[model samples]
Target: MSVLPLVFTSGWASGINAYAVVLLLGVFGATGLTDEVPASLQRTDVLIVAAVLFLCEAVADKIPYVDTVWDTAHTVIRPVAGGVVGALLAGQSGSLSDITAGVVGGSTALASHFVKAGTRMAVNTSPEPFSNIVLSTAEDLGVAGIVTFAVFHPTAAAIIAAVLLATGLAVLVFLWSRIRRFLRRRAQRREEKRLADGGRIPGRAGPPPW
Candidate 1:
């Protein structure tokens, strides 16, 4: 069977939580759940690194501003991970060209990453941290569930992932205003901090000269 479905699903999941996807796939491969997983992904060193990163993300993703920072840091990492995984999957299955799989995975991950990042920015506009925690937990579960499901039912998982990606994009579009507000507020905060740290120069308390 072709590995496109799994590649697509993994790409979408990778956008939200690349380490989790890697960790889960590695575990599955090591356990002999499936032979489709690449040997490189199942290495002890790779599993350990992925597990550590997943733990870090699981913690950092539940904090509002921290999640946004984490997302910013992974903007490149996620897409690159997706492409590499896709290429490996293709190489193992011999069902598609590595370049083709890599491009599809990387582009899908990039799109979904935008949706995740934009939604998080909008969510950060909320005053409380509970929402972030809830959303983060949901994303982690979703990534885990979908990737595991893909191991057993690739086509079905891909369809579900497509729906999720579409829904997330729609929600992000609806929340564009909130995302913009968050960006503006964040910029203001940075400017305020900079000014505070730099010590503003004294000035006359009068209107500027016309």
Candidate 2:
């Protein structure tokens, strides 16, 4: 029972939604639903704090600009949480050094975090808010499902996480240029719209009436 699979899976999930992973693991550990989970993670204080943060994230993550801001703020927090959780998982097995697990978790989380943040930024270029809400909800669900599965089937979950991470990165790379162009076009459109509406563009005077 190498904890590597759980470490990777949890790290990936944490990048997307660390609080949810914490809340789910804590709840499962507290209820004796999962023996692999660490006791400290099951503490009442940990659960409460995770729940509160999760709630806040749930709301903030559905707002376009706000979600980006929230993501920026959490650029460090999520990876650290991933490392901590990974270490805790390793501690349960006592077969691996906590430092090793922490490195794996932190590195995996950082990769996934960049993917998530970049995708969210691209999605935010759209003016509609529903896409943000939908994407956020999907991420929350994905984290919950993967973490739950990881508890009982770590190897399978790890495989799945790896596939997903690779696929997402590939897609992002393939579309990177297109995404940048699209965002630029959207910005230009917005600027034009504002000028047409007699709003001044930064560094430019108001447009003359047609």
Candidate 3:
């Protein structure tokens, strides 16, 4: 079977939760459920580490600002993970060039990551914490479902992932205004907090230069 579908699916999942993607793929590989997964992903140490990080992300992703912070931190990590996984998958399957797979996976992941980040920013504008938890839970379930399904039905999973990616991007675009407003408000709050903590405005400070 062509591994392109699985690569795309995994990349989409990784944008939301790289650790979960790694853990799921690793488990699937280790349990003899699929041979398309690379052996490197199935190592005991790899699974354990992925499990630990997945738990951390699961917790961090349910909190409001914490989730945004976590997303910011993973901005690079997720895309990199997607590329590496794609390269590995291609290498294992020998159906596609590793570089081509890596680029496709990384680009897909980057686009999805932007959608996730923008949507979260818009969501965080809400005062309630429950939305964050609900959204985070939904994302986790979605990633798990799509990834597991990919192991059995790669082409179908890829199509589903593509639809989801399109939907997410559309939603992000719809919420772009709200996301921008939220960012402005957040920056204002941060600046206010910094000033409150004795941070002075450049060239307009009252404190002595001592």
Candidate 4:
């Protein structure tokens, strides 16, 4: 069987939560639920590390600005992880070259990462933290479900993943202007508050307050 479906599905999931994807795949592989998973990922140490990191991510991802920081840090990590997983899946089949699988995985992960980051940025514009928490939880659940389903039904899962990816990108595109405007307004408000608090406005000659 072609591992392309698994590669794409896992890549999409990794963008949302790389550690969760690793943890789930490692667990599933260790438990003999899937034969296509890489042997290295099935190691106990790998599973433990993935689980620990996933826990930290789950907590950090619920916080607004903190989640942004987490996402920024994982920008490279997620794509690399996806590529490694893709290569491993291809290795199992011996039909596709690891490099080809890596390219597919990395590219997919990168695209999904942008979508995740953009959506999170927009959500962070809201003052309430509830939305962030809800979104984070939903992402975790979605990754888990998609990964598990992909193991058994890769082709169907890939189609579903493609649709989701398209929808997310479309929504992001449609709201890009609104999100930018909101960010600009937010910056203006912050600047105004700073100025009101005795901060000098830029582009004006201001006597230094001794």
State the lDDT of candidate 2 residue by residue for 59-117, as single tens digits. Answer: 99999879877988999999999999999989998867899999999889988988888
Over the full model, what C-alpha lDDT does candidate 2 score relative to the true structure? Answer: 0.90
| lDDT by residue for model 1 (1-210), tens | 999999999999999999998999999999999998999999999999999999999999999899999999999999999999999999999999999999988888988999999999999999999999999999999999999999999999999999999999999999999999999999999999867655544574444344
Stretches off by above 4 angstroms in model 3 are 200-206
The models' CA-based lDDT, in order, is 0.94, 0.90, 0.93, 0.88
Write candidate 3's Cα lDDT for 1-210 as tens digits.
689999999999999999999999999999999999899999999999999999999999999989999999999999999999999999999999999999988988988898888899999999999999999999999999999999999999999999999999999989999999999999999989887857665777675455
TM-score per prediction, in order, is 0.94, 0.85, 0.95, 0.87
TM-score of 2: 0.85
lDDT leaderboard ranking? 1, 3, 2, 4
Give the TM-score comparing model 3 with the true structure, all chains together. 0.95
The global Cα lDDT (0 to 1) of model 3 is: 0.93
The TM-score of candidate 1 is 0.94
Write down the worst ten-residue block by lDDT for model 2. Answer: 200-209
Question: RMSD per prediction, one decimal?
Answer: 4.1, 4.9, 2.5, 3.8
- lDDT for residue 105 in candidate 1, whole number 0-100: 88
What alpha-carbon RMSD in Å does predicted model 3 have with respect to the real structure? 2.5
Q: Which ten residues in a row have the lowest lDDT in candidate 1?
A: 200-209
What residue runs in model 1 are displaced by over 4 Å at the alpha carbon? Answer: 199-210
Order of quality (TM-score): 3, 1, 4, 2
Q: Of the pair 1 and 3, which is ahead by TM-score? A: 3
Model 4, poorest ten-residue lDDT window?
201-210
